[model samples]
Target chain A: MTRVASMALATAGALLLQGCAGWQSALDPKGPAASELAWLIWFFTGLSALVWVLVMIALVVPLMMRSRAQAEPLAIDAGADGRKLRVVMTAVGLTALILVGLTLLSFFANRTLAAIGSDASLTIRVTGHQWWWEVRYEDATPSRILTTANEIHIPAGEPVRLLLTSTDVIHSFWIPSLSGKLDLIPGHMNVLDLKADKPGVYRGQCAEFCGAQHANMGTFIIAEPRAKFDAWWNDQLQPAAAPTADEAKAGEELFLKRPCVMCHRIGGTPAGGTVAPDLTHLASRQTLAAGTLTMSRGNLAAWIADPQGIKPGSHMPVVELSGDELNAVVAYLEGLK
Target chain B: MRAAVAMLLFPILVLAACQREERDTRPQSALGSGEQPTPVTTLEPGGQRASASDNKAASFEANAFHMSEGKRLFGWFNCSGCHANGGGGMGPALMDEKWIYGSSMESIHATIRDGRPNGMPRFGDKIPDDQIWELAAFVRSLGGNAPSSAAPQRNDDMMVHPSENRLPDAATLGKSP
Candidate 1:
């Protein structure tokens, strides 16, 4: 019986510890704001645990002690009663001090969080849709402003200010390993500043329920060296490379003719539709349908072929196409990188 | 045992009734006969009622799916570019009582099919007839002519005005433009 209980306990312990470290876990913070929040969380949790233990000890100690039987069971000793009152008062005083300490800790933590974004040099406007993020990098030059979806690239050790808003309903922008959750309400803008401590990929998710596919909404922040981040931004500004293969060329023609042209825009082509995400850098993205599936040719074909099947109630409509046309379109999108 | 079975079937029957049937977008001859080559600003010269075929096309005004589809198409086709989400930009304001061509369904259909002089381009060649009817229904709804139950609640775009569902019925406005 002991062996079975120990084995079960060990398994449960292992499972709980697994969540402590991950790309998305708040406990595994990779940025300044998240680290400060993690420290606050740990401090509060430790203090609360200590208080609970002390309470349990106080409750059980008297119960375990054998009290001397009095001649009159209801009679109380005046000296002992006075000692008990003093102990109770001390306990109350300590409780008040702990509560005040916690309040001050949280207050200081918020101030630290507010200061993280004070010297931010970069500004990106992030608009929340039903189940996707529309990231627009702001630049003084109108032509230099770059628009992308789902993925954000930032320079390591540099603070970036995010102007958040929503086009439709209410949603929240939360990157657990970088910062806290901030709501993106329609017609209202909220600003958040964050800086990655090192170069790494951190996953983010919509912390608020917006619509049907809200659970599938995911985003990524890629922190890289300053030079590499600049190179990526410049490359994204270029038009999509024209398809070299005959099959891909045919695919582009079909895409132009179909309803796909009505919602998506591919730079340098006449297929300029602003309602959906820009597909100019389709292959460059790490995932499809707002991270519902990984970026692959098969997943792309499956997504285009049956959008409703993968992400039901999405705005994407299924355009009827033959098997050959599907493959051709997939080939063309793959070459977009 | 029979009572239990009946109780189980009752909810299923109720749920089955809630299922909405999809609209058939295929062109029908019923609407074809009612279509007028020229726009009709008023009822027939003799003050006659609308034709049965005209009523058939107008019935789509009560369908929620049809109205929502029209709303989607309005954006997809860049109608908002000129119309500015029914408040109008270069084009006339659809939400207002003043309709230049006409307010009737058939008149609106004719205007869309054969573009009015100067501004409205001819979409008759590009868009199918069924879609034209849907657009007409949506335009009427924008003017608060549609049944409140069938109108769209809100749009995903930047807030401009009250949604179609919240607008007062056009009849209550008291005068026809």
Candidate 2:
């Protein structure tokens, strides 16, 4: 009985701990934008709670008043009626005053949000797809702009402009630790500005119900120091790494020869398909299939073997392969960093 | 009066929600189970595709209305974003006389369905084959072969608008409520 009780307790603890998974915790602000939003939320919540308490006290006061005070209304005294009228007017005035204060507070908070956007050094155009983020880092020279998917890397402590748009149904881009939610409307653009206070990996999700695979559409923001960020940028600009091993070379060849080449691209190789994420620096990313699995040879092989089983309704197809071929492909992908 | 107007609008709002996802923009008579070329057709063209194919593909005649539908789909699918209404940007220029891949109906269909290397995204998964056929038809017309009546209408939807295609600023934005 003790053993069973301990097992149950362990399970309960694990479940409780799971709630604190900070994939996108609004309370844990990592940026100026999120911090301001957090302040606004707390202020509004506290004020609303105070108002509720006052209302409850008012509701209880009439009941709590002496029996003779209540009977004054039945006796029809003019002074008593005036006093009651004054109390009702005071309540109305308080309600109006609270509302006006909140409205001004919201207006100022909006201005604060807008102010952060004015001085963004870097601009990233994020196009929302059915179930993925197509992120592009812009440069003054069109050719120098870098395009990648799912993962976003930025220099910590610097404001960045995100021009959000969608090609299909509506999707919301939200990085809770970094900024608030912004809708990506088809044929329209909305700009969101954000910055990170410290270097860290912050995860995000599609806040809007886009389609069948909306729940699986995940992205991450990797904020790093300036020099490190520059190195990452330079590395991304270069072509895919050449395979060193014979097995990896064989896998690369197999990838190009099969239907994989029909929908995915690996830079410096003949296999260029833009319909899916670019695999030029696939190994550098932390997760596969937009955070479906951790980046590993085993996970890569599993994804290649049966993507449908892992992320049902995902665009990635089950590329059936012999075990050796699968191993080779995984090696090729793993070597891409 | 407001209540009466709202009552009148309720049914229309419900009906708007009930609108079919599939296209019925074509005429009622045209909505038939006519032989549509297999959505992934590599078969030689019969229709505007062949008329524009020169001698490269099998010929089939098409109507102006059908070609216009194909043109509408081109913009709808964001073909303009890359191809820029067939003048091309990231993808090759469809308006050019020189064809890297063959200028035949079967070849074009194959290219659309089974994407070519070097950034030609496979639309096979996202787009229906029938839509691909229409796109192929519209694209083939870009080489100055489409009948004027069958030509695509210029819509003010491009981000960088041409002088003629530009909308008034008020229209581009929504009118004031």
Candidate 3:
């Protein structure tokens, strides 16, 4: 009873560690990416268990059949139980061959699944900025390639091909629960096709070390139903409207007057520079500064005051701006729906 | 028993032989005394005088050839992290006409060897003198300067000396950022 309890404890400990094995858990067939990988693990694990069980039985059966008195190495004998040994050998050999066959089948299955990519789906061009992702949905009508700052939304169950490129150095696109990462290289377009199996919000971050602020370069994907995506797409198609209120108008004039226009791009407006993240839907995002802080009035105010303090090594130069000007800019950006 | 031992040993021997063959075919660097193609080039193409390989003293090739080494090292050490490929980033662009410090070859060499205070770390001990010069040359080349014709001749110019810090700046470094 004690031995059994200890064995159970050991198994539980190993299982706990295995469960924490972030990317390689067999039980984590939670999405399309992990599910695909799980199939490979299942085949290999099954074969491994079978082989181990057979080997254990072969060793145990020999001991069980013999008496305790005869539990000793026998003198070297050429003539032994030839028939029984031949049967055992043949069984193990066939088991090994089956294991090999299963492995080959799994390998081919993996290759076949990986070969299917971006030919039939809508292509989204994702460019990595200093610490943000510039997502452009190329297939939207008006031929709109809307640059959403960090959070990306897509229609559920539809194949989406991401044409990954980096504006600066190398950065990797990784949405853990959805799919494996594809690197964004400069002067090179690497295409990765992915589809969310279900409608849910999945967290992702930059897997490559681009610079100092690489850690805060997080992004999330909100996979919604087709109807909702269409609605969002329609909203994105509209041109940038003129500021309605007096304060917003003041803010817009200030934004144009300041250095904000030098680095950022706001579509249908005069602020057309490509050095920084596109702020067309800046207020629409759930977070600011490339998902570093929540998009609140206070957070936005703090971000404008000192960007370096919030995210070290970000390219947005910190300039001296009054609290009123900051509020005005934030209000103007917030109205850019 | 002999056959069983042979079978066990056979796979190990085959693996060892394969490893040996791989090792033998590896490309060797020519800057060393042994016969190997130098990764660094000594020739500037436009009929330049060959300088002696006495690396301790300042040679005209140090500016031309070493700048090339610096360029190669820039790629090698992944300097594109901040000072991106001919573009500005968190760090200033090296290719543009903007130089934060003086743009002389010596100043550029100093900037690389001893990193600037505002984030760039000193690469003095990490990289060799020859390679630093090559990097400088590469940075100059990016700024549209013609390759110098007065570089050293022998492949021995490829020596990446760890302590030798006798690299001279280009006659004209581009303007600072």
Candidate 4:
């Protein structure tokens, strides 16, 4: 029975050390922060295993000795003197103290990290609504912040601060591989300072369950090289392009006559409504609708026809138009770039 | 004491049985009764088959294709705001039948590609045609305040122009132009 229990303890400990395999694992390699975290996890996990072994020794050794006592009753009190009791108690007390000390050290490590990295050069304001994160880069020229939903791009090896707030309700901004989560509460600004040592794409999800589509409120951060970052920023600074004379005429006809401008914006065009996402650089982005779909004509047509069918609770009203009209509008939008 | 315990347990059992009965009766009415399930729509995207364009004519056989594409675009670019779960918020709900704009495949397509006035931004050049169509399909599927029986009709006179932005044009505009 003692042997079986010892085997079970060892097995459980081993299993705990080997976590589930997947991209979901925080220990997965992506950035310096995650790699450092993986090492910390392994160190603590190893220490825990050592403590479990000691506990097993205290429990199993006594039972093993007791089983032998049945065979040789004379040896029962031989080594069972108060000395063994003192030794066991001393070992247990010392192990407990070591655990407490290690835990305190970890706590201080986290605190020190938080205190040092709280200041950043660039401040990106993040506002969370029910199911999306509105990211605005505050340092751009013309006092216009480039609005990108969900995905955020930043320069690697730089300290970036996020001033997080919520538009309506509570939300949390979490990018596990880069930094810890920071909550966005209504009427309050919580600042989070994070840095990525390497350039790569890191996944993030809303840690707090804000609403029904909360699970879908996920995003990624792309750490670009300084040059690429600058180029992207430069592109974002450009105003919304003007359509070709022919396409613009078609777009204008479609925009003014088709109820297209009621809930949209075209930067300098008459269709410059702001009820939806700002489309100044709409054609420049790789995806659309808060990262809900790729930027393709078919997907765009389907989305414009019926948004809720794809992403329930979307705000754009489903406008009805004919196939030719849909095609003309698509042509005009495709030319926005 | 035993009698009191029995009294409590008996009522609990009856309530449980009643709940079970309700569950059993629901499927019977939904399946054979031919009753239109007045889908109780919500602002969240998970509830109900909120496809707005599914009810329209010229049924695109690859229906789920556009929706799936839209879902990916939504996650990648993050369009869940204003639209709120794709149903609408500060902006109009996309799932209901009450589209402030027209509700045809073309108008919906144009709206997404170009964006609407009153704050809707254009994606005309930023996104590809294929993706825009799919997103439009997904938006249409939400069945925003449009009537199912009314075929998507064209009304050129009702076309309203989009709003303008304040930024200056980049040199790239001349190249594209």
For each candidate, C-alpha RMSD in Å?
Answer: 7.3, 10.3, 16.4, 16.7
- Candidate 4 C-alpha lDDT tens digits along A1-337: 9999999999997787466333345666454445556667778888888988988987898788745336665666756688889987898899889889888867865775465355666778888876677778987464556665667889998878888998657999877777767799988999877777888777788889886567777777889998999898777767667666675558657765554564466666666544356566666656766557778878777877676566665545455556777777776776666
For model 4, the superposed segments whose C-alpha errors exceed 4 Å read A1-25, A68-88, A115-119, A140-144, A245-249, A252-265, A270-275, B1-177
Reference-based lDDT, residue A9, model 2: 100
The two-chain DockQ for each candidate, comma-separated, is: 0.15, 0.05, 0.03, 0.03
Off by over 4 Å in 3: A1-33, A42-75, A80-99, A111-119, A140-142, B1-177
- CAPRI grade of model 4: incorrect
User: Stretches of candidate 2 above 4 Å error?
Assistant: A1-23, A69-75, B1-177
Best by lDDT: 1
Q: Report how far off residue B58 is in candidate 4 (Å).
A: 30
Q: Tell me the lDDT of candidate 3.
A: 0.67
What does the lDDT read for residue B97 in candidate 4?
51
Q: Write the per-residue lDDT of candidate 4 for residues B1-177, one digit (tens) a residue.
A: 999999999999888877521111011212221112222232456654553432322332135544544555554444666776565787787666566666655466667766777988876644544455556666675563233342232222223532235333565544744
Provide the DockQ value for model 4: 0.03
TM-score of the second chain of model 3 compared to its true counterpart: 0.46
lDDT of 1 by residue, A44-93 (tens): 99999999999999899989999977899788789989999999999999
- Stronger candidate by lDDT (3 vs 4): 3
The full ranking of all candidates by TM-score, starting with the best, is: 1, 2, 3, 4
lDDT tens digits, residue span A1-337, model 2 = 9999999999997887576447688877899989988888889998999889988997899799877546445476788789999999998998899899989988988898899969899999999876788889999987678888899999999999999998767999999999999999999999999999999999999999997679988999999999999999999988899999999999988887776886677878887776678888999999888777889888988888876677765556455478999989888999989
Error of 4 at A212 (Å): 2.1
